[model samples]
Target chain A: MKKHNYSAGPCILPQEVFEKSAQAILNFNNSGLSILEISHRSKDFVAVMDEARALALELLGLEGKGYQALFLHGGASLEFLMIPYNLMKVEGKAAYLDTGTWANSAIKEAKHFGETVVVASSKAENYNHIPKGYVVPSDADYFHCTSNNTIFGTQMKEFPSLEIPMVCDMSSDIFSRTLDFSKFDLIYAGAQKNMGPAGTTLVVVKEEILGKSGRNIPNMLDYVQHIEKESMYNTPAVFPVYASLLTLQWLKNLGGIAAIEKVNEAKANLLYTEIDRNPLFKGAAVAEFRSNMNATFLLNDETHAPIFDKLWKEAGISGLPGHRSVGGYRASMYNALPLESVQVLVDVMKELESKI
Target chain B: MKKHNYSAGPCILPQEVFEKSAQAILNFNNSGLSILEISHRSKDFVAVMDEARALALELLGLEGKGYQALFLHGGASLEFLMIPYNLMKVEGKAAYLDTGTWANSAIKEAKHFGETVVVASSKAENYNHIPKGYVVPSDADYFHCTSNNTIFGTQMKEFPSLEIPMVCDMSSDIFSRTLDFSKFDLIYAGAQKNMGPAGTTLVVVKEEILGKSGRNIPNMLDYVQHIEKESMYNTPAVFPVYASLLTLQWLKNLGGIAAIEKVNEAKANLLYTEIDRNPLFKGAAVAEFRSNMNATFLLNDETHAPIFDKLWKEAGISGLPGHRSVGGYRASMYNALPLESVQVLVDVMKELESKI
Candidate 1:
């Protein structure tokens, strides 16, 4: 049976990337050394780091624009704290939009460093929609928002053009679509979603926005120090970074983010159309705020839940189970997820509907 | 052409561990999903985490001893700061022994959190010997030391029985030998030299020693929080942790630290004996403090450098070059390195001597 991976994170990567990464584990660049054992400072792994950083900026259309890209360990969860630690000052206030779990977590961490104002929140609606028409405080040092909510499957369609610097956590939706790169001062993503593996976090920061925090940032968490050391300030997540480099190469070869966004749109539209048209299920998020990356839905007839789950599982679907906080199905269609997998899911839904 | 890997970290792992890890990256547990794509919360990876933690504690003879083992990201460098952040209070002082590079780095980070006193240092000798007979201040919150200096090639053969808590950085020599586990309140090691890879760090902390800092530690850096979450406080360096698990399994199957220590001693003795007898080479560290993990040596005649280098290269040796701070050869014979590799290196030395 052909397995369809719809895992939320540490999720899906291109098959070629997996194969290449596996081969590298055996012998990296024919160095007769496993990628697992090679030094990050070695010329072979250095090229991997350089290419990964370059490709991230290139895909975001921010190359040579004073934006530095770094692949660091500790996932996005750590970034939640590191961002505020390095960017938020003791007296300054940063504005955050609480869309879902990750954004709320970010806001919580930012509060430890400085005053954090929740500019907008959709918590009242169980985070089923993206908040809009929120006011950004002029006194705020920066306006932070999560571009995509992986749990509730709500995505911000239009970002607010703020006078203050903008920081975005694009963990789930990064590189899945093309966005204006010049708008945000800092952007970070955990690589498990649209990128590669789970270990390394991708941080893209505008160099000019840093050094204004006026606080002593720890060396490992300091953006300026990491940039100065070229992300080799310490031994990075070498295997994950190398896997990310391969994925970026695949993305570049397929014509970068612009080209992938079309496929992503088609995949999301395919499943969402099924959810809307089929009487058995309904979309989790509002139609207007629906995420093209993570399409979440719930069955209309709760009694048929077991049947639907069995249908999908028999069809070789994996990681389609929704988060415990949101009890429903979530099909994460990352950059590596193919249209065929989405069709398989859509077909399973159609089969369940017809049987009913 | 067999390769003799002697790289200091991101260093050699057992060939079987490498093979299994590579296979898992392709299809983990026959689940039709790559280990790279599985969620940390998934049962498979959770098992990996649990087994790794259990095996670490079991090997250390600290199982059920009120200690916690965590596999975290950001390397030992991050732990350098985390140690102080979670242990050092605002007005409290911590005592340290400045042995070499990593220990000094740890001291530097400790100073950021609280008053750090260097109880002893061998900096005057360029760290060629481990300082002995230094009394740790009774007023100090804890006593910290580096068990082995990777760059300086010095190892502390005996640990001080301190009245206060003892913290040791065993990055280069962890699991390579058996030690009295109850003597230290905390031990941290980067998983590159003897353990596994470079990204993940191993932290074993006594539960009772935590919460003494009386400072608000950041969520990610807090030992209590991570312990509560079983080190899944973040997404973790999943790949590295999984690799570390496999390596731990390999170590356990080979009869754990006690068995490996014999092999390590033999390999170190084989190389050190050659370095002493071979006129072409001279050992760098004082014989009393010379490391069994990293054997640092220099050529007797600077003129023979090129020839000696060529001979080693021709014999398929890797990572034998010394750090720039100490201009000599450093053959790091971690647990994974077989005695055969040391014999090959010793043979290369003899060949160079014959040519001379």
Candidate 2:
């Protein structure tokens, strides 16, 4: 039975990626050795790391720009510290928009470095929408924001332009939509959502924005050192990088973000239409700021959950339960998630309405 | 042809580990979901994380000994910075034994925290032997050393008794020998050598040694935070941890380190004895401190290099070249390398002498 895995992270990837990853583990590039055993510095694996980094920049349309893409260890959580370490000056402040849980966490880590100013926050309203009219301070070292919130199913539809360096955590929505990626000085995403698996984080940083922090940054967290080493300053996450290359290759073959954006819009539209039309269900986030990658919805009455859950399980749907903080169902429609799966989920939702 | 892999660090693991890991990537535990696609918070993956952590402690005989084992990212290189951040006080010093490239790197990172004392160093001797008769400062916050030097083919046979905390970077040789594992307050190993693949790192620390640094440790670099979250403080390297679990299970089934230690010694002795008996080759490191896991050697006559390289290639050996600083050959015989592979290499060495 095929499963519609809607896991928020460490989430679904293309079937070809799983097959190729398994083959590499058994025998990498027909090299008579498992990919797991090969030296990272070897020519074969070095090519892999090189291709992964190059393809990431190519996909973002940041090629030939000042950006250097790095496949680093420690997920976006570590990036929270690295951003402050590599960007914020000694006693300087960073401006952040608090839109969701991840954005809030980033703000918390940034506060530990120096002064952190929250320009505006949607947290008081349970993060159901992207905050508007947020004024990023001009004198701040940088402005940070989360592009998509997986937990609350909200996404920033329009980013605020700033004179200061702009950084964004696109962990859930990177490569799902087309945007002028060059506008942001530093953009990072964890690989589990819409990229590959859980292990490596993709960091795209413009070279001109680094080394101005005026602090004694450690080697591992310093972006300049990683860029200098070509993401091999130390041993990188080899398997994750290889798998991500396979994914980026998959995305490129599928005609890049421009082509995938149409399909994403179709999936989101199909699911959201049912949520609004059905008397039993209602969308969780505000309609204007709803995420295309993850759709959070709640039943009008909680009593129907058992039957709805049973129907989805029978329909082979997994990871439908929302975050514990938000008690509902979340259907994550990452790039690899097919529209047919969303159709199946919509059919199940319709059936729940009919049965009730 | 079955190639004999000799790459250091990201070296060979058991064949069963490769097979099982590949199977899991395709269909994990008959769960009908690829392990790469599952959430870290899922019941299945949480079980894997628990098992891997528990088995690491169990194999090291540290169970119920106030020790906590964690799987982290950024490899041993990151642990260098983490050790200084979490152990060294704001202004106090730490003692270090400079053994090899990795140890020197650790010492470099420790210097960023406070005073770093090089108690003794074999760097003057080209790191050919572990320094002895060094005194660790009693007032230092901790003492640090590398258990085995893969690049230099040296192993510390004895560790000093310390009043302060003791930390060991056992990256290349963990789970290969039996040791008084509880003697060290903290031990970290990158999981690519004897453990599994290149993504997650294994950190085992005695609980009582933490929270004494008095520095504001970032959440990601804090061992206490990771322990409190059970290694899921952030999204862990899922595929690496699962693969490591497979390798750990294989080691346990093979009778743990005691059984593997005998085999390791036999393999090392077989190769080293032939290197000694054969006039064409000479061991690189001092006799007393030669490592059993990685045996670095050189050709006595440089003119025989072509034939020696050809013979080893014909015998299906790979990753034979030594570190660039040490121009020679290194045979890395980790826990999963079969004894028959060593026999094949020894046969090739014998063939080289006859042909010459």
Candidate 3:
């Protein structure tokens, strides 16, 4: 079966990235050492690290703008705590916009280190839309927000330009679109979604934003330490970083983020159009806030649920089942997800509607 | 040229493990989805997690005991801080045996959380031997030790049976030998040497030893939270864990820890015997404390340095250059390293001696 993977994370990657990564695993850069076994400090792997870091910055359009990119382990979840530990002051407060689960998780960790002010939240309506027009405090140490909500399929299209430093978790939607990279003091993403594999995290931080927290941050959690060491403070997630390098190279060869943004918008539109036109389905997030990366939807009637699921499964659609919390279907159309895959899902939806 | 990987780690892996891992990366379990793309929540990855956890405990002979095995990210460096964050109490003290660089790193982190006492150390001799006959303070929160020092090429041949909790960093020597598993409260190893890759860390913690720190441990660093969540407290290092599963399976098929220990010893002896016989080279660590996993040595004559380096490189030997801190050569022979590779190193050493 030709699987069209819609997994929110640990999700789809370009076929080229997969092929290259597999080849590297067998014999990394013809070094006769498996990528899985070669030392991170070795010339071949170091080149991978250097290239991955540079590409992450270059793709974000933040090259040489006093930003440093680090590829580290423990995923974006660790970043939730690390961002607060390294940025949130001991006695000061940081502002957060809670869009969904991941944003709230970041808030929960920030609260442990210092005071946290939830400037805005869409949680009241089960996070069906991105919260808007929230007052970010000028006095807060930093303002943090999640750019995309994976479960609810709501994305923050326009970021607020705040007086305080801006931090964002771009985990699910990073590289799916072009963004104003200069506005964020720090941007973190787990590589699983649009980047590469599930091990490494991409952290791009503006250099000046660190060393002001005044707390004794653990060396592992300190962004300054990691930045200074070029993400080799500890043995990094080498395989994932190498794989990420390949994916970033793929993204570059496919004409970078600008090119992918068009493809992403088209993929999202194809699925969203089917949901809107079909009588059996309803889009989950509000139209304005609908994510270009993740298009979540639901069956209009409970009776159609089983048939809808079976039809998609038979059509080789995987990971479309929405999170248990949301209780529907989520078609995550990341950057690498071709329009044809979304078309297949639309065809499945149309086929199910004909039965109805 | 065929490569002999003696990398301190990310190091050598079984060729079968590499082949299987590379195959899975391309098409996991014939599911038509790249392993890099499949959801970690999928049945395929879930089975991987389950089998990996089981195999780690089974190999350590801790199965069905109070020990809970967790595969996490951030390597042993993260464990340095996480160990203290979870085990060290605010007002209490922890006893440490400062064997080498990593042990000192762990001690450095522990001091931030609580009072840490270096019960014994061999820093005077540049960590060339493991400290002996040190009394562990009973009132300390825990007694921490490193089972193997990768940089210094020293291993703890004996562990103290202490009344207080025992925590060990077995980053370099894990799964290379059998041990009295119940003696330690926690055993953490970065899975680069003798395991799989440079990302995932294997943590086996006694269940009762947790939740006693009385500190607000970050969710990411809390072992209790990770154990409760079955190591999926967050998106784990999925690819590395999958690779580790294959390596563990390889170890089990080759008769587990006991079987590997004999092979490890033979490989160590083969290299050490050459270092002893070849007057051109001298062993770095004291004979009594020399690590069977990492055999550190130096050229008896500085004039032979360039020639010796060239000889090993030409023989396809990699990662034998000793750490800058301990200037010499380090031949790290992990579990997957065959005697043939060590023999090749021995041959290179002998050839270098003949030139002299």
TM-score of 1: 0.99
Summarize candidate 2's per-residue lDDT along B175-264 as a digit string, tens digits.
999999999999999999999999999999999999999999888899999999999999999999999999999999999999999999
Cα deviation of B60, candidate 3, in Å: 0.6
Q: Evaluate every candidate with DockQ and list the scores.
A: 0.77, 0.89, 0.85
TM-score of each model, in listed order? 0.99, 0.99, 0.99
Task: Supply the TM-score for candidate 3.
Answer: 0.99
- Candidate 3, residues B1-356, lDDT tens digits: the string is 88888989989999998999899989989998888998888899888999999889999999889899999989898988898888888788899999999899998888877789999999999999998989988999999999999999999999988889999999999899888978999999999898898889999999998999899877888898898898889888888999899999999999999999999989988888888888888999999999999999998888889898899899988888899989899999998888999999898888877888
User: What stretches of model 1 exceed 4 Å from their correct place?
Assistant: none
State the lDDT of candidate 2 residue by residue for A237-354, as single tens digits: 8999999999999999999999999999999999999999999999999999999999999999999999999999999999999998688999999999999999999999999988
Question: What lDDT score belongs to each candidate, Candidate 1 first?
Answer: 0.90, 0.94, 0.90
Of candidate 2 chain B, the 10-residue stretch with the lowest lDDT total is B321-330
lDDT, model 3, position A204: 95
Off by over 4 Å in 2: none
List CA RMSD, all candidates.
Answer: 0.9, 0.7, 1.0
Local error of candidate 3 at residue B144 (angstroms): 0.7
